[model samples]
Target: MPVPPPLRQRILITGASAGLGREMARAWAARGRDLALCARRPDALERLRDELLAATPSAVVSLHVVDVADHEAVDAAVDDAAAALGGLDRVVVNAGVAGGDSLGLDGAEANRTTARTNFLGAVHQAESALRVFRPAGAGHLVFISSMSALRGMGGAMNVYSATKAGVSALAEGLRSDLVGTGIAVTAVHPGYVRTEMASHFPRMLMASDPDRATRAIVAAVEREPARAYVPALPWAALAWPMRLMPLGLYRRVAG
Candidate 1:
């Protein structure tokens, strides 16, 4: 039998304090994978690190308190984490925030924040990860974009959708650019997931549990899939139609 890929490889995950990132950490720990987890919240990061270490004796967990939006800080954190892990085989850019208001007031500020956190932050994380991957000659990049990127939405989510779209494009471009380098880039477009990030939205809008969504993500990584739509049902079906729909129609349907 062919030898299976080692589950003990070290991986780095941003925004690992909660939501999908937290669940991804749990999924990885269960498989005995070492992790370098980063989030703005130090307390939560420390707690998660402790929990993972306790649950998986074979896995090593390191926690870093840093914000992805801060490019320099993120670069330093990634470098230190990569060093501590000896090297990184995978990096998940999951840190993001939703902005823009339904009322449209202060929309500029919201859009700015959204662009900075969602698009630029992912770029920073990816650059840091790739810096290590390029030299090492093998690694994986997991970008956690949203299903909203498939279509332009109205209401308070316009900028959020735009940022997600940007992230998706980044992943696709990276995949093409890194061809034959043994580095795989996976773009994950997930529908509404039940997490603190979606709490502001109606409960009906939230579709999948974070744990289930994360399982699909990690599975896609292990399989080295090019792109993935979590749950892979209505979401996969809706992607194209949503992209072609008019703004008015999308707003009415999305709202």
Candidate 2:
């Protein structure tokens, strides 16, 4: 029989201070998974750590404050997490931003910020995570992309969708390159989930609750699939239609 991959005991998640990241930490902690939570806020991280420890005293929860856009800082934080956890079995590149405006309508800085945080930040996290995974010869890397990645979006979602598309592509490339290696990559494409991130967005139709969304995403990650459309109901069924929709109608609904 083929040997199965080891249980991913130690998990490192970026953007873990709040929203989906925080909820994912809680879910994994309940499962007795040791976690390294990385974010820009120390207080939030500490609060989450305390909450997890209170709920599951045996779970080891580490914290690291980091800005994912800075490759050097990502390197340091990821390395630090690995060291603290005695080596990382999994890394979830979940940190990202959703701020953007229409091209020409807004300054380049707005779009640039989104690009740096969403796309480049993912690149940095993947690079740093691989440094440890490659040496260890085993690891699971998960990327939290979006349903927006299925097709081009309009208005503020344009840049965000593009960034997610890049992330999905990155995950696919890694999966291809690491075919023979024990390392695994999973791309999670989530539709609008009720969270602070979605609150900032308008026109979120049939959005799933935070708990439901977290469950779907965590379940998909555990499966270590090449790509997953989370919640599987509407998002999975909607992917093809979204891709095949007429541009005029797409723009109307997407906007």
Highest-lDDT candidate? 2
Q: Against the hidden true structure, what lDDT does model 1 obtain?
A: 0.87
Model 2 spans with C-alpha error above 4 angstroms? 1-8
Clash number for each model: 0, 0
Task: Please give the TM-score that candidate 1 achieves against the real structure.
Answer: 0.93
Compared with the true structure, model 2 gives a TM-score of 0.96
Provide the lowest-lDDT 10-residue window in model 2: 99-108
lDDT of 2 by residue, 38-97 (tens): 999999999999999999998999999999999999999998998998999999999998
Top-TM-score structure, candidate number: 2
lDDT of 1 at 116: 96
lDDT of 1 at 4: 88
